[model samples]
Target: MRQFSENTFESLVADTQFIRWAKGEQVADSQKWEEWKKNHSDKTREFDEACKAVRMFSFATPAISDLEVDYLKQKAFDRSKKQRNTLGTVVWMRRLTRVAAVLFIPLLLFTTWTLLDKKQLETTYSSLVENRMDEEISVVAPIGTRTIVDLPDGSKVWLNAGSQLTYPPIFANNGRTVHLEGEAFFEVSKDETPFNVENFGPTIKVYGTEFNVNAYEEEEVVTVALVEGSVSLAKSGGELFLEPGEVSFFDKSSETIHVERKNLEHFLCWREGKFIFRDASLNSILRVLQRQYNVEFELSNPQLGSYPYNATFQNESLEQIFQLLELSAPIQFDYTKGYLNKDGAYVKGKVRIK
Candidate 1:
């Protein structure tokens, strides 16, 4: 038997057991079922949550069958084939091909469809709550994960770790207002609502602008770096405007603000799938890495935290990323098993020079 990592366990369960069950295979007596629950508790919890969510819905119930399953498989295969052929082709041709392959699946064959019409309407509304959910024109990142959220207005947001941006699911009647926590970069679309991002320390108001924001809490100051157009920063009862190639730092503790001009590419590199560092300390770089890779480190040598380096890595593997780091700084790392305690699995990471 081989030791299974988190990625392996997740892939096995999703690919083998789940697919077989969906395809109507006899899986109740399989050893994989037990192993799946044992190795991946998160997947088990997610399954349970999904079941609970469906139980709350008053609308149709769907069941799987052999013929229907075969049809779906064929549909998926055909869709994939069409997509491959349509790639690098004209958009209208792909649209026509998709229209030719459409199939409809009914929700449920319950005899009480009319009896639960009102209840179904309510359930439908609840499902769409996220539809009306506010999406302010701000960059938002999750606490431990990078959020690649697409805005309701067709704009894309690359949110960093330990940050969150709150906006309506769709743009509202007036403007876009998003609240931020840690940091994120934005490539805004030209919309009607003046885009405004309110960070923990300062409020950044903009309209159809590109910028990078570094306003992580516990830092000495909040920084907003603009790459294009103009941004307005309001803090401590004062308003300051910034232009391209300029950066603003506001000190919340002291109620002071500092503005400077610098190369915009240095800050915009992360959005391009690269990490650019110029004389950045190990600790500073680690902070960004933790956000990007969702990994934590236990520095064995406290002094190693102060080591500074300048480098850039774009779309590099973990091995490549670490090798690049080692080229400039002497350090070693290991892939650790997730911590398994009474609460299940949690990540544990460490970094040191050997």
Candidate 2:
């Protein structure tokens, strides 16, 4: 207290006890300061200047209406009266201090809300940038092989033989998209954004669904079968919706699509290493076998291509498959071993059906 009497203006304003008395908080300290002033009449001018400076240097806040300021002033006065009987010199000196406190409350709340909103905006923008920076990746199920893939979006894909898939390392914010070549079965995860599969000429869109898509480039038609859930097939100028156990066929030449109810198990059986045919033509069955075994076929009789066949073969070797076909149909197969090329590498063999 004695040191404060001889202190400079800046030091007195910075003192915690002095600030408390200036703001009418420390009643005991205020009484002590009054006694000190009486003993040191010569420093009265300096003490008054320090108090005035502290009050004038209050923090800035948003403007309050005249009516609001008066309301706050009245509230402060009423609260202060309940605490003390007389409005003494301390209250008179710190009248402006109480008003500043009232105004600062709203400003503090506004500042906190503004900071939180800005942080949320920055986080959303960072997520978008991260997705855009992600690189594209591709996976292939080569001929005679199948592959199972887990996507970044928690979806699972079973790629059939001779199929290719291309996607991003990380999915974009808006949705997930992938490119497909031959055939695949997708068990898509449920999400707000739609999952899109782009084939040769058609696009399949779904939210959460189990479906099979066969869009081989060489085939004249693209097939989509929904084993469970719903899917939307979009083509050049139209779209077709499919429910569970329904199939969609899109013709490339006519640019038309047809939807029909069918046994989805037939389309999805290849995912489980099963070959199922229900009165399918011999040509179509041979094409499926060629892709599955990575072998070429030569039909000695062109008329045999239209012969209808029905069979279900699971985990069957090529030789066993050919034997089954010969027994079931009027056809005989001859196998020929391929010769080595100039590089001394043996080429693939062929099976001819007569």
Candidate 3:
């Protein structure tokens, strides 16, 4: 009934009750051992180590019968008695070598188990990745709505109004790739794996970069602006590289690409609920407002499209924006309520600017 902390490896191996518990041979002995371990929390680590060693030896040497186990215990006891009587180093060394030879089989098994366990874990992880690659995921930012999403590879994306993003559940084996429909600002994670964003007419590839992509299918132009870091725009004919503060424009109709140096803040401002326009044409500005408010617009004079406007707005109602537009320019707007559809739901309102 020695305390668990005071028990030595040799003592634990010699005890028949401990051996039966370690080998899980007796349910009653296992229950008692578990209770003892719970009461002696400080000795748990040592008890586990000793039990594991005994179990390994028992499994490795399954052919060694109970009679052989008793014979080995007797021999160990006799060696201890001789050491106490004579204290002869040569005799003790010989007996120790014989005991080590008997334990060598378990040591080999332990090494083999360690290697096999590592391989099994690696195989399981690879299988998990392969399974995840076949799964797809998609997120959409509806009209008049903006959203922030976190990608599988720890990248963050701020999706603008009327944008759709499609990607895999887990980016595995090859690289990270996503499809964009409207507008999104990406703060991509830095990694060895390349990240690709495919749009309508161009595919943007990046190592690690923060950039904004505007590829609204309705628009004639697809543009990618680099806020920081570098990106490559791959088109049908050639590939173009972009530096910080540079914008790449791809004309879908002409199948041509061009890059320009401009202030990227203007392009990325929409992600923060701000619409910034610098000398933008009135018609172009109306289109943006239409998308942001999910409203229809009609101009009484097509010549108003030639007028230039510079403005910045944040979280403003449609009436407030129109009021500012009226004050800044010689224009008037008639706002009308929308009509109900077949399902009896009112659609978006229309605005007439003259």
Candidate 4:
């Protein structure tokens, strides 16, 4: 719902998703908003100001309404309208002076509504905005856990460990779009509107297709592995289409994409709670292991980062997985048990590999 392109206050306020985005309710851009701010420096100031305005504004009508009182007020307005239409200016001006105090009760609203046929103009717009904000949703999969999310369009997503997925409330009514970080396997439901998966900077477009996108914040590249159906990954300056059983790697620095036809199993094995690696480099394996095991790894021998290895692990403890890694390569790791920090939360088991 990109409703506005200009940075003017009026335009920013008019954006369809502006209120949610500004109030931190929209997870699409808010996930990587600082990076977006850095990239779009010229508009950051205006964006910040708009957010402040949205945060400060709220519509809370005074709680003083009665059916009987409202009916009486409507009668008064009707009577005044009829009298003003028939009276001379002098008589109308005298009546206005007499009723000025009562009219000023609502701070000029009486005068404004009187000339406009006595109608309140704000109720419709407020309800529309409230409904849109209430519909926006965000789902998160914490470290060492996975979640299966069912979107409004009947699209199913297997959100990987330590990942998040967010979709606007208007998803089913309008376009099929979701924002993703880390990784997810998507089984998009077929529809006339295309399904778009927006990651850090690239967007994956598909129609009734199943695909896997790995775009972790700490990963070196954005990876898209199509399981079935066609998809296109569009980055800043280029777009690459992929057929079934194809994978594309987008390098962030060079903004280049490399495509390869590899066994889709390795890219999707995690969906079944299995880590299957075939000649994956030592560094790549460790990266996956870290996310899967919720551990931190430091390589004493940086040269070993690229050492090729093969392995499959499922339902194994972190220690057992380390033992398997040692058996595959000339590598031994020292494990440090995790501890609860000041926040009273256990996090980040540390491992040193040599």
* Candidate 3: count of backbone clashes, pairs at least 3 residues apart or interchain: 0
Estimate candidate 1's alpha-carbon lDDT, on a 0 to 1 scale: 0.71
User: What are the lDDT scores of the predictions, listed in order?
Assistant: 0.71, 0.85, 0.86, 0.82
Give the runs in model 3 whose Cα sits over 4 Å from its true position. 1-135, 337-344
Model 4: what TM-score? Answer: 0.60
Top candidate by lDDT:
3
Q: Candidate 2: worst 10 consecutive residues by lDDT? A: 1-10
Cα lDDT tens digits, model 3, 205-311, are 98557999999988778989998898999866577889999998889999888899998888998977899998988887887887788889998999998799999
Error of 1 at 144 (Å): 7.5
List runs of model 4 lying over 4 Å from the truth: 1-130, 133-135, 172-174, 236-238, 341-343
Cα lDDT tens digits for candidate 2, 194-257: 8999997579988557999998887778899998888898766566788888898889888778
Specify the poorest-scoring 10-residue window by lDDT in model 3.
1-10
List of clashing residue pairs for candidate 2 = none
* Tens-digit per-residue lDDT, 1-354, candidate 1: 433355643554456545555344588756765665677665665544433444454355587888999999999999988887777476776676676544221224243575588788887666555554532344546444577767777666677777777776555557777777777888788876688888866789885468888877745677789988888887667778998889987887887888999777777777666788888888888787777766676787789888888888787765677887877666876645346677786655544444
Candidate 2 TM-score, true structure as reference? 0.61
**TM-scores, in order shown?**
0.54, 0.61, 0.62, 0.60
Stretches off by above 4 angstroms in model 1 are 1-145, 153-155, 170-174, 218-220, 252-255, 330-344
lDDT ranking, best first: 3, 2, 4, 1
lDDT of prediction 3: 0.86
